[model samples]
Target chain A: MWHVDEGTMNAYLDGELGDRGAGSGERGAAERGAGSGERGAETVWEVETHLASCAECRALLERVKRVRDRAGEILASSSPDDVVAPPFEEIQARAEARSTGSRVLQLSRIKRLAWAATVVLAVAVGWYARGTVFPTRTEQVSAPLAASELEESAQSQEPGAGSGEQIAASGEPGADSREQGAGSGERGAEQAEEGAATVVAAELDRAVAPADRDVAGRGAAAQTQTPAEAPSTEVGAAAPPQAKAEPDAEVKLRQEVVDVSAQRRRSDAGDRLAAAAAPQAVVQQVAADEPGVPVGGIAVGEALMFEDSLWIAASEDEAQDALGGDVPVIPDLPVIDYWTAPLHGGEMVRVRQRLDEENVLELIVSRVVSDVRAAVALRGIAAEPAENEAQIAAKGSLEAVAIRRGDLRVVLRGPVSTDSLRVLGEKVR
Target chain B: MPTDWAVVYRETYSDLVRFLHRKVWDIDRAQDLAQEVFVRALDVDAENPRAWLFTVANNLARDEARAAVRRKKHLVLLKGEAEARAAGHADPHAESVEERERTDAVKRALETLSDTDRTVLLLWDAGLNYGEIAEQSGLKKGAIGTTLSRARRRLVEAYERLEGGHVARG
Candidate 1:
């Protein structure tokens, strides 16, 4: 007896009076489209039965149908003339490329701080490797450079105005000298690939041709870390008169500026992973900036912003002036170049003295300061003093000896025995 | 298993473009918006992808419209230049021009309807049946019929009003 509503009339007209499927609703009027289910059939019967008798309902349905048809016809006129969606393969390519691009952008932004960070890493790792990597090299190269070689080695020490001082003079471009210490732990890197251009080979031969007999007289500090390293060092030791490293032995213990740079370039991955070994902050930064780049990629960038806290100077005197206190040295080892990043209120200063063209000695003279917050701590650096030996944990591969002389802590890093390194530490005291 | 988007793309592409073309009022922009929808679709995990696509497409269209309104003056100038360029083109078929005029008339009619009414009408036109329309428009399933009936009546009346005005002006 009740009149059918306008909605029912339109529903019947549009042929969409349908029930849902499954737990209902996500399916678009699913099932059989129009009036399909038992519930839908009942609605259809009720609407139709009402329409059969009600002339008013039929007229109303007729009016709605005309309006609907007119709209459908009008909308049909605006159908966009043929559109082809881009191939799915193209979208997939875009996603991959975009993912790589975003990582690059992140690294680019990081470089603003990262370039400076590399220098901090270079110095800090040099300091840390003195403790950890040295003990390992001392075990490997220690016996060769015996106690007798210490005096001979001391006389052999010629910290000349080498490339480091020359660079220091020219506004102290920190990279070349600083990076010399960067991959010192990888002294055992595999020899440069053979068949390098003859011109490059000739230059490296001349450059790598440093006094190896003199270095061996200094001791076999360059060999025996790895089997791969042994062959190159043997080549250097065997070819004494020719210095060391021929077109084959390219292991210049005094890293050929070009060879060292090349070595730095080659060992970049290993160095960054090794470098990423500490200070918590650098690891977090690297992880945040480049999720794709292994979390350890730039941990080797060891320096912290000594801004108001640390500053690397151009000259030793300038560093001394900045320290406002005496910067200790290994006496006769002419302080070729020293850069300082003032820490714990100028309580510490790092002196990088060239032991030979092949070695760098990092003498960190710090007056007893409470704060040990220098980013110099690598993973597993033993802080405890064992008997009378410097707390030497064989870290990477750099040979170092740390001796705390009363209030002063002197760390000596080079390719020498713990005893030989102690002699160097002895000179500093 | 991941949704086979390629299958959905091929099936719904034409309808999506047609739907976007009405909202944006430009064939090129409509196709671009449709591609954008699919591009974003690739990243999401939609249980009901078809419904998800249209919903995202609708929101994107609204955002595009808001941006278009801010750039309306610039668009008016661009439209003038486009009209001039079209006028200069040599068209031999009069039927093509008549088809364009009819589309313009329909576009004008669509712009006059209230947003909800226009959305209800367009959702149905874009091939969403009653239940989908009700879900998309947040209307009761039964009320979708009533909403569509009202929307269609207004749309036709608006078109006739425009047609009569054009006849008078001519």
Candidate 2:
């Protein structure tokens, strides 16, 4: 049988002696021999024989027993008070506080967003109501005549025949004279008047002349022509009363022309007003369509007026179509009130000039708040300057301006004071 | 059914700390590590609470020792200074009650030889016999005799040196 070694002894004491303890066959046989508790057990016999014969080995066993006993005693005597524990309650409390704080912060953020949405919704509804309520105030006035009416009036006043002479000589002019002559000659005055009125109404009902047609074509061409030898000969010369009434006729005609001109001017002005108001309405409409954009306190500034180059290039209908179906053919939006907070830097004030989907320009005003002290310290300066130095530096410095637009809101920062903000409110178009 | 941790803590915390103190040289650190082991045990599946507590305490001591070795490598100067301060603080009380405790710990360490040897000694101290230790420690029954003999020889050698009036190196 193989003798036990120190490595094997260590492994066995450590309880790592399974499967690979030295000399498996001999060890198994020795275990069986010892297990029987026989007086002459093989393994016990060998160990006892060695202990009796070898003094060194026996001494080692005795020492091992003493050592084991001492170790047990030390382990038993050791006390529990030596170790410390972490304060778990404090950690748990801190964790709970952080969780509750974050939840509160999240709730507040949601509340703010909800308020902004409500404001935007109210503004959009108000704008739409205003547009629908006032219609006549937004369209232009035009004279109600057509081209066929003028032609019918001209045809009824035929001249040159003896009958036409009688018609012309009658006290009334043109169509009125024709009606008077027809009654005195053959027809009843009532019939003639009815016929004359019908013809005149029909003539007035004609289609409007093209705008390109000259004014001269509107007058009686036959009256302007003269027979040979009479350059300025007067017709119906004996009727001095008629001749005296000519100035009145001229005055009446001039009055009609002036009235038409004034009406046209009013119409043009109304159209321009409507055109000017359109983009503001469109911007409001777009803001309403998007659910997230803030509407309340969003003061719309005067729309920068530029003639739409594409609209000027194309016909009105094409321009209307290109702008999208939602934009009406005639847009009549009023100027919306808007404001932008200015960003103030040392001696420079910045304001937001314009805002669109993708671009923004800020107006920088220099030295606007020249007397006010800065409320906060400048970034990147480690030690705060002394009180005196701060006072000297505070001489109303304008800070850098930033113009920012996000998914929901737009902001402009500069040196604009509260008074300046109020003034800006008045100036918005 | 699992054992209740609150009961386990009430019953075994003192014993567990004492057991860990025997394993680790530093009693304060041992107590701290033992408390951590109990806290962990509170979360463990408790089929056998006592065994689990013992196992976890042993593992934590082993981990602490490995960490100490790593820490010693990085901050050698700091460690040496700390040890010196600790020794200086203990010097006045060395001949008093603390000295007896220290001697007892040294004697126990001498009793435990290799890691395997110490484990077996500890299992035995826990009142497990050779057969039970074979099952707990995965040792074969046949090899226990010879292995114990060699382990005993080493333990005796270690004890004799301590008994021979040799001072322990700090």
Worst 10 residues of 2 chain A by lDDT: A301-310
Model 2 RMSD vs true structure: 26.6
lDDT of 1 by residue, A1-429 (tens): 345555556677777654333233222222212442212222565667767987876786787778878889888877766577778777667666656755654564376355446546554554443323222322223223333332232222323312221111111111222323433344234112111221232222222224312332122232222234334444333323333323233234333433333433443332332333334444344334322322111122121221123435557676666446667787766677777543322335678786655556676555444112233332222222233121122233344455666555555655444445665665664
Q: Interface RMSD in Å per candidate, to 1 decimal?
A: 17.0, 15.3
Per-prediction DockQ scores?
A: 0.21, 0.07
lDDT of each: 0.52, 0.37
Report how far off residue B98 is in candidate 1 (Å): 2.9
For model 2, residues B1-170, the per-residue Cα lDDT tens digits are: 76566666666665666666656656677667766776566446766667667777788877777655533432332236676455534533235665655556554654558766666556555544466455555777545555555555565556556545545542
> C-alpha displacement of A293 in model 1, angstroms?
31
What docking grade applies to model 1?
incorrect
> In model 1, what is chain B's TM-score?
0.83
Kindly list the per-residue Cα lDDT of model 1 for residues B23-124, writing each as its tens digit.
987777888888878877887778777888899999989977865553443233334657545643333322486676777789889888888889988988
> TM-score of every model?
0.44, 0.32
DockQ of 1: 0.21
| Root-mean-square deviation of every model | 22.7, 26.6
**Considering chain A alone, what is the TM-score of candidate 1?**
0.26
